[model samples]
Target: MERDALLQVANFSTLFACMVLKFPQILVLMRARSTAGVSLNSLVLELAGFIVFVSYQMYYDYPPPTYLEYPILIAQDVILLLLILHYNGNMKQSIFYAAVFIGGWKLLTVEKRVIDLAMSLCTFISASSKLAQLQCLWATKDSSRVSALSWGLATYTCLARIYTTVVMTGDVQVLVRFVAMTILNFWVTATAMYYKPSAKKKD
Candidate 1:
């Protein structure tokens, strides 16, 4: 009973966090009218990761609670991607990217092996996304527009998902993904904070 209660809390918390996971970033971009410190590659790769993960969960009939947040996260990512493209004055490319992402989503579940392969690569895809963001921060050396709050919230969601994954699914692949995400999210959060103009000003 206690374990079940904990799982519920963790699952709901993760869901809630994911619902607004990208809002801070989105708002920052809108207010600043720039994509200065954000990585378009990271958003694209992260969207791919979300699609594969949710597809894997659905293919295997995993518990809805375990992966429910993914769809919401994907939607938020789409909005973020559109906003990024708009700010970059490359909105015309949105159609091509959407077609590719949609086609990739459908192809992932055409065969059991295909999804398995995709899931196997999901961690790397997701990790690469975070690394891309890190590279953006490193290149810009200014995270004033990066939304550390978004990354910090992402870290929390990943941590919550880790607990929920263990208690609910016990799927090694999912567990590994969450663990790696948690570390990367934390790294991004710290990096963003470290690069803040205020931090530099204080130094």
Candidate 2:
């Protein structure tokens, strides 16, 4: 019983750390008042992944394994998604797309196996989009426009995920996902460093 309690505590701690890292992104976005350099595609895909994850948790009646992680993730994604859509002047389309996608998932009442598969696919898509966005930033040499605080938070979150995966072995697929995310996080950090953005040019 003691061992199980300790394990649970450790797991919760790690998950909390990951969520904490991501929480600041919301503040950063609000302060910047611009999602200019952030990738809308990445945010969209990430929102998809989070929706799938939350659905799976609800379907399984699983005590949300990560405590506050999912809630904060969903909140941040929603805010960021809205900001991106508003900035891009696609608010209506974005709202429609989100409603359709989430509604479809709910209507399907997908099985656990199917949910797992779909969630994995969404994770990959989201990660790929983030990588592409980072590549775009590098290509454009406009890292300055990106939020440094958000990037730092992402790096920390990825590291926390890695640690959590290493500590838990119940799900091989999840471990693999975290490994991929960690690698991608490192690449993003490197790009951010190498392509540090300059100050905004005078109007």
Candidate 3:
């Protein structure tokens, strides 16, 4: 019982940390009032991945923590996505994206196998989106809009969660996914470093 309690605490702590992780990113965007180094598509894809994972957990009737993580993650990303759109004068575009996201969410909620496949595919797609974001950062060599601290913390949190996951479930696929996400997070961090100075000069 004691060991289980400890594990539960660890699990919740990790999830909660991840849930609140985007706050720093949000702050970065709000303060700068710019989406210069950020990618709206990347946020959209991440939101999709979060939705699919949450749906998968719901389909299985997984633990509350699993289901709860969805809304928490969604709440953060929605704000980020909206902020990105608003700053980029793409708020009208968000309406269409939201419609499509809602429709996709509805479609995915219907079946178990579909949810499973989506979770898998969304994970890969989200990783790819992040990679694309990384490429953008490198090409522009300007990560002024990127929150290095937030990405660094997120990367560390994923690494910690990956350790906890391996210790708790020993699930190969989940481990692989976590590993993949961590690498992307690291890439995000590196992008920030690649463009260290705060004030980016226009060429």
Candidate 4:
């Protein structure tokens, strides 16, 4: 009973965190009316990784609770992506991105090997997404419109999933992904906080 309770807590905590994972970034962008310090490449790559991971989970018929947060995360990412593109005056490119994502989704599960391959590379893909954001911060040295809160929340979700995945799934792919994501998310949070304009101004 205790184990089950912990699993429930972890799953629900991850879900709740993911539900608002991108909201801070989205709000920051909208309020600032700019995509400054935000990385479009990072958002696109992150969205792609989310799609692949969720598709793999669904393809394998894993427990819903283990990955229920992904759809919410995906939806939030889509909204965030659109906002970035709109602010950057690249709204027209959204159609192309949407089409590619949809097509890739269909193809990923067409065969077991395909999904497995994607899962194998998922950690790197997801890590690249974080690295892309880090590169952005490095280039600008300003996290004006980047939300450290969102990245911190992401770190929490990934850590929660590290617990839940071990408890519920025992799937190595899922476990590795969560582990890698936990580290990267924390790194992003730290980097964003470091580059935050307010922090710089106070210095």
Candidate 5:
């Protein structure tokens, strides 16, 4: 196969892996109806980041993301929003409004600078969320509450980011995000190993 063909195949496989892991994590959250141990701050930041990232893609005329990526991310964000509202006993009208405003602005605007600014903002939000998650794990000394599926997703995301970084010069931001996520994943996984839930306690 030609070099471009090989790159395409790799990208497809990585995208598929990301979708597989991400969807399962969303399903787990939905079925559990409990963000009990999950970090709300992280979720909020992630939603913010995703909004920017998606907008960037749209503005830059990047190829359409896989169908699975869009739906899974939407589902995850919606679920997180609902969980926050329910737990805090606060209607998230403002959050919804903000999402709408930003999304609309991106859709209506044509300037490349505006899109670049959005991407930069989104990247910061994403980093903040990841850092918040790490802090949560460290403070509690318990990674048991984090969804296992998220860890799996991180692993695949790391692999995919590394591949993309090597193949595509424009993907540096994504590569950095994935690298940070991968490191956090290892930390959480190690903490989880030490704090496994006890079967006897459950009974």
Candidate 6:
């Protein structure tokens, strides 16, 4: 197959992986009902990053079919956040968090170049999410609360995107974000594997 065809395959295949992969974290959170080792800061930063990323995609008029994934990502993460709050018995605080995220996303509108700025900010913040998780692991040396499946799939998907960017688009502008994200995801995955929680913590 041509490079373009292969790139398309890699692109959609990575999308499919992301679409199916995110729920594992939520599921793990639900079963555990505790955010002990889980980094709420990481989730908040990730949601912020997703908001900007989605806005940037919209600015470029990303294809409707594939672009739908961004909103889906936002929705699922919102649900996950709500679930975490509920389990922590902070229902009122949950509402506040929701309000903040919703208001922030609504206020993201500006000029075209502003969208580019947001996208760059989003990429940096998204990578920071991984750093937050890494710190949590480093401080506690417990990967118990982290979801391996979720991080694993995310790392794999991001790597696939980097490959597609290199072989297909050859667009440095597009490749930069994915490359950065892949590095962070790989780091998180490595830490997750290196630190093993006790049996009770794993619950």
lDDT of each candidate versus the true structure:
0.93, 0.64, 0.77, 0.90, 0.62, 0.76
Ranking of models by TM-score: 1, 4, 3, 6, 2, 5
In order, how many clashes per candidate?
A: 0, 2, 0, 0, 0, 0
Span of ten consecutive residues with least summed lDDT in model 3 = 61-70
Candidate 6 lDDT by residue in tens digits, 1-203? 68768767777877777687768888777787787777878888888888887776677775543344567777877887787778878778987887887887767776776777777677789988889988887887877767877888888777777776577446565578778888888888778877865432443
TM-score of each: 0.98, 0.76, 0.86, 0.97, 0.72, 0.86
Selected candidate, larger lDDT, 3 vs 5: 3
RMSD of each: 0.9, 4.1, 2.9, 1.1, 4.2, 3.3
Worst 10 residues of 6 by lDDT: 194-203
Q: Which stretches of candidate 2 lie over 4 Å from their true place?
A: 1-24, 57-63, 165-169, 198-203
lDDT tens per residue, model 5, 110-134:
7777767766666577768777876
lDDT of 3 by residue, 89-167 (tens): 8789888988988998999977777777787796697697788778778777778778788788778766765766666
Candidate 4 lDDT (Cα, whole model)?
Answer: 0.90
Model 3 vs. true fold: TM: 0.86
Q: Give the runs in model 4 whose Cα sits over 4 Å from its true position.
A: 201-203
Question: Lowest summed-lDDT stretch of 10 residues in model 1?
Answer: 194-203
Q: Which regions of candidate 6 are displaced past 4 Å?
A: 64-68, 165-173, 198-203
Q: What's the lDDT for residue 14 in model 6?
A: 73
How does model 6 score by TM-score? Answer: 0.86
Using TM-score as the measure, the top candidate is: 1
lDDT of 2: 0.64
Candidate 2 has a TM-score of 0.76
lDDT of 2 by residue, 9-111 (tens): 6567656665565555556666766665577776666667667756755665655553347667777677777876776778888768778777867753556
Candidate with best lDDT: 1
